[model samples]
Target: MTDQALPRVVDQATWQHELDALRVREKAATRELDAIAAQRRRLPMVALPDYTLTGADGPVRLVDLFDDRQQLITYHHMWFPDAEWQCGGCTSFTAQFTRLEFLAPYDARFVVVTQGPIGEALAYKEKVGNKMDWYSTADSPFGADMGAGPGEGFAVNVFLRDGDTVHRTWHTDGRGTEQLTHTFALVDLLPYGRQEEWQDSPPGWPKTSTYSKWPGSEDVAAAYGPQGVSA
Candidate 1:
């Protein structure tokens, strides 16, 4: 970290008093989020028609992604046509899907779906975490219909499967998936926010464009951290 302008140093009592005020607002915001979630759960669901999606295991039905589970949460991963790489923002977001075994006990399945070829999707996992479950939507409109072709960006689709019926419960776009990154939340808590140009950092604080510092080569990972979680 470099020397930069910092929030004014304060006395212990003054710090506590300031923290107390923020805590009240934080509590209220948290409750509001909880209420929002309840409403999200109650939102109407849209049925998905039978469609094909390719995985490392070859062509498979969309329902197969559910893995005999009643619920499936898929990250609508973005891919480039060049077949050499993936979107950095998508990489940063999908990295959190690792170690999500906790979803299994609850009968939920998580997957990353891409419109690129299966080979590219598979190569993505190899460059990143080989353990990640990545799929290719191929020529199928399954991804576009479910909200992938819109902005050439990404989304998170929540689904509920009952017998042969597949229902889309909730879906969130790129910005909506921001909460998946615990690291970003941690960064927000710091005096300097993300140190990225897109963020409104104070003068003298480090800043870079959100898309800057991307890995120059497809094989190399971006500098999200030493652990390979690309920002």
Candidate 2:
């Protein structure tokens, strides 16, 4: 285990060959994922249930939020009223929000649903400078019906609606999994990088840090309101 006796990984020719093989595998994986995505898109539509939810503009119909867009992506942000603050992971992930604007040409709309009041939702959006559309379920039952209320967990669910019919195309509620897809996925394909310094990063790549709760962190409340922040 001494330094001199350790294997030399930095100067190995085999390493390059292994990297090449990995590149091929990555390409194949990408192709397979694209095919599966196509299948999801082709799935048949279902009737969109009647639902009303709070919006920055006021109480609004679920279908109306579609804004005539054929595809809608909703992020069920953990924005409960009594909750202290928004999820930090969500805050970080939201750095990718502006990218959603580009999807407009494809007839896709992205929105975030919060359990907080519309004013609260708006405040958070302003504080974070998020350009994506945001709505609240504070005065309505939409979040509960969508399984996005308190205790419901964090998720991003995509729905496809054709006229009055709606179909849930996909749902992802897992941690950090959102980075795997979206226009961001396309960006990650570029040579410069995805910028996420996860464990799978190649050698010498910088790793990123996850936020840690420190002493008195609970005292810091969300500026949205007295109860809007998290511990």
Provide the TM-score for each candidate, comma-separated: 0.87, 0.71
Give the Cα-based TM-score of candidate 2 against the true structure.
0.71
Best by TM-score: 1
| Model 1 CA lDDT for position 101 | 85
Residue by residue across 144-212, what tens digits does model 2's lDDT show?
A: 766677656778777888777677777667754555346456655654345454535556554444333
lDDT, candidate 1, residue 206? 75
Q: lDDT scores for all predictions?
A: 0.77, 0.66
Residue-by-residue lDDT tens digits, candidate 1, 1-231: 537677778999999999999999999999999999999988999887998888888889988888899999988878778755567667756665558789889999988888888987776666665355888887688889878972377888899999978999998885688766686788789887777787776677777878565334343454333355553
The reply for model 1, stretches above 4 Å from the true place, is: 1-3, 198-204, 213-231
Candidate 2 lowest-lDDT run of ten: 212-221
